[model samples]
Target chain A: MSTSPTARRGNAVGDAWVIARRSLKHIRRQPEMLTDATIQPIMFVLLFAYVFGGAISVPQGGSYKEFLLGGIFAQTIVFGCFGIAIGLATDRSTGAIDRFRTLPIARSAVLTGRALAAVLIGLLPIILMSAAGLVVGWRTHTGVLDVLGGYALMVLFQFAMTWVGILMGSLLSTPQAVQGVAFTVLFPITFLASTFVPVDTLPGVLRTFAEWNPTTSLSGALRAQFGNPDVVAGTSDAWPLQHPVLYTVIWALTIIAICAPLAVRAFNRATGD
Target chain B: MAIEATGLVKRFGDMTAVAGVDLAVKAGSVTAVLGPNGAGKTTMVRMLTTLSQPDTGTITVAGFDVVADPTEVRRRIGYAAQDATVDELLTGRENLIMIGELHHLGRVRAKERAAVLLTQFSLDDAAERVVGKYSGGMRRRLDLAATLVATPEVLFLDEPTTGLDPRARNELWEVLDTLVDSGVTILLTTQYLEEAERLADHILVVDHGRIIASGSARELKRRIGGEQIRAVLRDRSRADDALRLISEATGGEAAFDADADAVVVATAGGAAAVAAVAGALAEAGIEVDELALRAATLDEVFLELTGHSADAAIEEPV
Candidate 1:
């Protein structure tokens, strides 16, 4: 009741934080919502490290366990997009977004809040996977600064993916549909990249596609920063793998720049206030 | 006028939801948009609330144009949609505080306002409980409370009691009455004629994307004549004679209802008309099963205006 006319113009940062706090409350009320991000990533780490680590070999003298850690970290962060998509879609279907749209707040604050919460939530899987990686004898030979830089890049990539999630969520009408579409589109993209296997082992068309996949740059950057050897020497001679850190940063920024505007526009149409 | 809308038209694909409607609501009065399903009541409310834009029209709410300055309009009005719009995961207090914060109320003020609203809506007991655990009436009260977080000058409720039980419906009506008494102009939509009669200062009957009738509740009843003199015949064979006698006594045309085996005539004179008809029927030896005189209801008025019963209006498509 004390809202001033100037304040009604919107405090994007404060409003977005308020919106983010709401999402955090949801996580507190229903811990099961975090299951896919936490337990699932840990399960993936254990399965691949114990089951597939023995057979697969890094092209260089590096341990496959160390090589696999970078890939797992990259895959887990990208999958965080699934949570964002489903949460936004659910908000839309439940009329939460409709109520928010009528409020005297910036339209972008709603998505900003969801995006921020997804990034915060994304941190859990990264930390959990890192712990699982250490348990599986995955050690980083690089210095402390490089390790921090690597995690920072991974978080940035997750932030970029959040925009993609928002776009998908805004376009889809139902939470179930968002989950279905996110799985269908993201599954092939994650697997086709160098996340689980060496790009050289992929057949002709997939190998060429993997060489250019953003996930390839993300995983390669993490591996290089962690001082883990590349999976295949001949296959990853491309510009993205050659300067993985720079390429990863560029890919993340580009995805955010393109997806952010499209997502906002789609949100306006979807909520329609 | 607190709200002025002229030639509002909205169309969805092949269907016209609102077709060239106009309205002028005073600064402090309750106006009910009375209609059945698909009568464009929801669409009209949506447009005025700035939740949806009209295909072509001009609407101003609380002195600001809905399209040109939606932010200003939104700042001045509150809307509780048909679908309850509270976050089920958050507690009722949390939902209200969140909305208050979104409206740019400072953190302290937001919390203070949330407390005030919870108590006002009689939701203080359920304030800390998650909305998902609350019953239908509690959630609806919370949703309405959420809209009042900023203390809006005008309130728009779209079918506020569509699915509530009779008891809960009456409770909500009392809450709305208190809000109106506080000088907040209200525009509510309802399918129930009784609801409109009880709550509305002025009623607009909408059918098939158009306003079919508009007047005060009493004036609308007067349009169909003051009161109805209804009589059930003892024998269906004498329905014609009973109808003729009732019409002669009341000096009004009387019609026979085969379904009820009754003759009903509309008359300005209330008890006197009923007595005269009874005497005439007795003189003709036309036995009567029952007789009564009652004020003309909005239901009868709707039937006379639209050539269809109010209940039948529910099944029509928008």
Candidate 2:
């Protein structure tokens, strides 16, 4: 039904920024909302560094605390998906998504904006963990460029994980369902990789799985970039472990390629007719 | 026409939520789609507003085809869903401004529009407060204000006052009346006959996904047997005598209301019918306890047109 002449449509990027700004405000209003990325990760760091670090030997004689930082970083970066999933689920259930769909802004702005917010949310964990790691006697011995590269990789991987979160959020019917399903899948995926322990110490099948896990590649890549333990490179014959950075990049890009379109499709199905 | 649709059909699995619906809403007129729950009123509104696609049919809103030029349709129309869809976490003013920004009003104009809407909806006092802290009525008003951020030409409301308290409902009705007076074409769906009677220039009764009847509220009531005069006799035995006397005096069909022990006559004669019935009863020495003329309610009209009460078990038509 025509009422007035059509107004100018907002550019997609600008619209996305507006939507992203709204999501980011939630974090500011409720600082406790950062518990997942901040307090929880810090707790894990303390628990691992003090309680478990002494017993678990680093693969290459490097400090376990230093080696542990890489795994924690990878795990937190990957779990950025859950934050995005929960946000999307809440939006869908609250009818906020329906409100957005009615606007004249670009439809792609909805998901892209959420992804942008997730990337920013992903930064909090990395920053907080770095401080927590320093307190626990963790340090990166690599050059400044390699250190920057490690953080950059974390952001790229976080970006890919956001799409997966969008997909899960769109497919899940409720926030409760998202929490249930996301944890069920993500918990084992993070644990099965080298996030908390040396992959060589696992059983035969589990070791093979961990060796090929994207989480492992990411952690190994971070270790290499930060000049931490080179255990995976020294002991593993696996192609991915040997070329951690390239392998992780391939995995991150692959996840983005596979999940982005499916996420968009699931999101459209959830919000559209 | 500001809004037009033909043969609109939407099916989920084997159940047809909306089947072969057609509509034409004139510009600057308030048309209420009156129906019970599960009558496809929301589905029809969704399709028209471009939130949902019809399996078959074409829709044109403000001269732009819904399917081919949905962005154009969206730019012209504003939709408020059955539930207040405002962001609870945002302040009342922030909600309107964000919607304005999405409407591409630009940040400065968006802020300007937000201020205007907040004051217009009497939400200025609560503008800085998060909507989560707002009362149900306040939230509803904020939701409506958000829709008006862009000065839409046509507005669609799906059960806008469904869950509001009486006072809040009346306040919302007043707001809608003002909008109509300012010439914003509106299409609203409601189960309340009073709401339709008060706000709608024309009403369409929908049931099982099709338009069963459409007319002014007065005409619809008249269609289902107009104003009725009912007389309760002091003695139940006099019901038969009362029925005959009432029908003869009003020259209209009469029936015994066993539940009320009253004789009811359908008449278009209004006050004259009541007078005639009262005079005849008294002249015939018929003892009457009470006599009253009542217009047909939408519930009765719904029953008459659909062969079921408006409050009947909501059937999911297959």
Candidate 3:
């Protein structure tokens, strides 16, 4: 890596940490903001896993609670990306970022910091959702290290989605626009993916999109690593459970590669006092 | 020169906000950009402070290019924009401390600077409170304090006294005077004629994206054609007689404005002309209410150069 700073190279990680730390302080100051992030996912997990657990069953799977957690974890992460979009839009409308533009700090630090903060906030929902999933009968067959590894990958998936959220936030004119656009994009992106069912059971068109979808890849990878029995990306000549980790990694990188630069350029165009 | 610009231009698509212009501001002096609404005063200041880019121009502040070396330029200058760009959630001390950190100051130094500025701006009493809870004057003062955290070589103040009360305006003027006395170069923009007159060492009169005149306040006022003799009327009927005598005495145009209830006499110098006019009025047995003479004000120069009536029936949209 080049030591010299490029226009694109900011202390993104450091700035992200500062913003994320500030967010933690904000959460502490106003605990009500924590309610949505820390409790919403758990409520959804409990509501779905118990209310609909009996009806959602696969032919070869046992204890639908075990399979539900992976799917919901994926859904929670994708849903949590909206926080980043809302935060960025708020900052833009208020000209907070505009003030940063006149400072000597690298230009990319503003969005990068906001995006990282979003993902850190995202962790609360993921953890609460996982615990709620376990209460409904989740039993991971993996060791402690594998559990950590699996959770880390999920975090990375959310982090990648954060960059996309920041891009949307920067492009949108207002916070209300962010909410509308997030709903429009996330509804289709989550529903078409294999969040609730196995890919083999869906119709051909839906199943094809589900199999290729990045969210499906992320959920599939986490489930396979946890020793869940519903994996079907393998053929007769291959292992019983196929690995989607590589595909998940690729998708995360690809989204960030497209999003990070676009966000910087869009941010540079905003006007302020 | 602390700042230099040659052919600075900023175009917003089809509309040119700042036409090509040249300017030089000496270090340790206060220069003001004076203009009415939409005269591009804010745009010119933004370009000079490196907050916005000029479409085509060469500009430098503190010997750094505003276009190519904006970061270096930003390091040497502190800019407080027309709108207060303050984070309301943060405390006053936090706002200033955060800015100090962004400037790469050590923690001890950042805290020290924040402490000093808070006291200097009389914001130390409210330093720990959130900005969202601050009053307008407090917020403005805290914003100014945050900008001063780095003690920059040059300062850019855009409409610093707008939205402030008379007391707050006077307080802010004193603060600016203090900063100016410490050898900091300042470039401020405002539509407040009295503000420019009070604080500016040199004033640049801008209209329609161009500088119409630039000089010391007295020089610009003196350049606005000569003296103005003004007097309030004891009765409306005496206006015609006063106008006739003043025109004959000064050998210049004399007019009485009914709305202003005052007579205007043009002459070489306003003080002597006022004396001469007063003596002539006494000899004619004309009674007067009030009379005085001084150099032309920014209001008069603005109306004359922009060709806008001071009391015309034009309603201001803002």
Candidate 4:
């Protein structure tokens, strides 16, 4: 042949970027794909901040609107799982995975690319919700370092949640199946935590679960860093609430430690020869 | 050989999808694996393209072992699957550019190549349009263009024209013809005998996960005694006379087909035998209800070799 196929070896990060760009373009073309990160979080802010803001109260003396933003940030970041799961499942069903497998690029690029894009997509809700928070009378009355640290924690938690999403996407066979999982499994998991309310008000059994849940710790950590209402120290015996930042770090690392390799293994098994 | 395989076998649980098959395709030549739906044509293509591992086999494409060096094999080959595997959300040009970038072509070169391929595939008008809005034919063309972004040496097409209409299929066939002229080795699978007859330099007829026959189209037809001229008689009483006249005219043995109420004779002569039979029958004052000159179709060849119709669906073991 006059133009023989040239061999070009691709590095993992570069290859992953190319794959991620494809998904990011999908988001651009179908902005509806970001509904979970954009429209849903804003709707939750309106629902909880206005519709239910009057009925609920923070544990300590603080504005309920300010307390609600931290929880909203935590809840939306966790739901970042749905986007990756649905994206991977759609690629699998459409035979796009097969096409990628036949290419000379690094095999891990497919999953890593989706994970990278998910984390980036996770930022949309954080930014949009922060704007919504300000409009709803929420403020972070803290120094720049503490606010940066809180945003850092949310991104770190988003990275952890991306792995969980990879695992779910690998296990599920279809986008419809992923949707079923998002509603039946993930929806309940987010609700069971202290996302919209204080753990102290939950039922006895659920209160313990909420205090230990990563979503609760993440929310509590954001509230503490933002100088919003939080659990009064030494009053509650729950260690996770007292040390929310450290607990959230532990939870984030633990999740990545457990789910990352399992997600990779599951993805390899699903697409392997 | 551009592609070679030996003792290829793949089993899914209790069922064998490809059973001890072998192949050797020469450089710049086209080979077609002709078969029914469940005849393991796709399974074999998957193995050859390194998309699936064979339980027992050795396959080498472009001189690299598929099992031992799949990356090398992947670098030299392109595959267009039965399904149009392009992303629906991406525009045609964007899809090609993405694949080009994945192939590690620099961004400038990738974009330039995408433009060229778009125009070549007659997709320039819809280059910026998302593939979700493209017609079935356009999608397949874009899928084919994506595979050609790197100008792969060996191409594997699994039923490339399976869902396309006749005009689209012909257009694709013409593109393939040009590729072959430029010395690209192709291994394609199809259920259409006409497709195999038109494009394949060699044909392998697969059934029940095994190749029951292999040769050029003409050779396979010759094996089934070349063309057959069948004359359905208007009157049953003239069957013997018609048979005798047909045999005399064609200088071949003619038989009475009780099931079809016709006299059938095989001939190496193609259309000329039909003229001779017509003249002889007219001279004898006999009228034929229907007369036809036909070559052995891939379906007829399958029946001749395996005693089953081509459309008989074999249960695919899950």
The candidate that wins on TM-score is 2
**Model 2 chain B worst lDDT window (10 residues):** B309-318
Which residue pairs clash within candidate 2?
A1-B61, A1-B62, A2-B61, A2-B62
The C-alpha lDDT values of all candidates are 0.87, 0.88, 0.76, 0.87
Tens digit of lDDT per residue, candidate 4, span B1-318?
A: 999999999998898999999999998889999887888999999999889999998998998899998888888888998998999999999999998888888788899999999998899999999999998889989998988898888899888888788898989888777766777899999887778888898999998899999999988987887589999999889998999999998999999999889999999777888999999999998999999987887667777877876656322321
Q: Fnat for model 2?
A: 0.67
Fnat per predicted structure, each in turn: 0.59, 0.67, 0.33, 0.70
- CA displacement after TM-score superposition, residue A138 of candidate 2 (Å): 1.9
Name the 10 consecutive residues with the lowest summed lDDT in model 4 chain A: A1-10
Best by DockQ: 2
Under CAPRI classification, how is model 3 graded?
acceptable
Determine the backbone clash count of candidate 2.
4
lDDT tens digits by residue: candidate 3, A1-273: 112211122254654555566555565555545776877778877877877778977557576777777777888788777877777787788767766777777666676667666776787887787777777778789888778878988888888888888778878979999999989989878877767776666687877777788778777777876766554644211221244778888888888788777776766665432
Q: In angstroms, give how far residue B15 of model 1 lies from its true place.
A: 2.5
lDDT for each residue of candidate 1 in A1-273, tens digit (9 for 90 to 100): 222343345678988999999988887787677787678888988999989888887776678888888888888777778888888999999878878877877777899999999999889889999999899898999999999999999989999999999999999989899878978888888888889778888888888888888888888899989998777466567788788789989999999999999999998888883
Q: Estimate, for each residue in B1-318, the C-alpha lDDT of model 3 and write its tens digit.
A: 888999978888888888888999998889999887778888898888777878888887888888899887766778887767777778888788777766666457778989999999899889999788988778778777777777777889888887788898888888888887888889999877788888889999887789989998888878877557887788878788888987877777888878988887767755677777888888988887887775677788778878974223113442
Better of 2 and 4 by DockQ: 2
Judged by DockQ cut-offs, the docking class of candidate 1 is: medium
Candidate 1: segments with Cα more than 4 A from true spot: A1-9, B231-246, B253-264, B268-293, B313-318
Candidate 2 TM-score versus the reference:
0.92
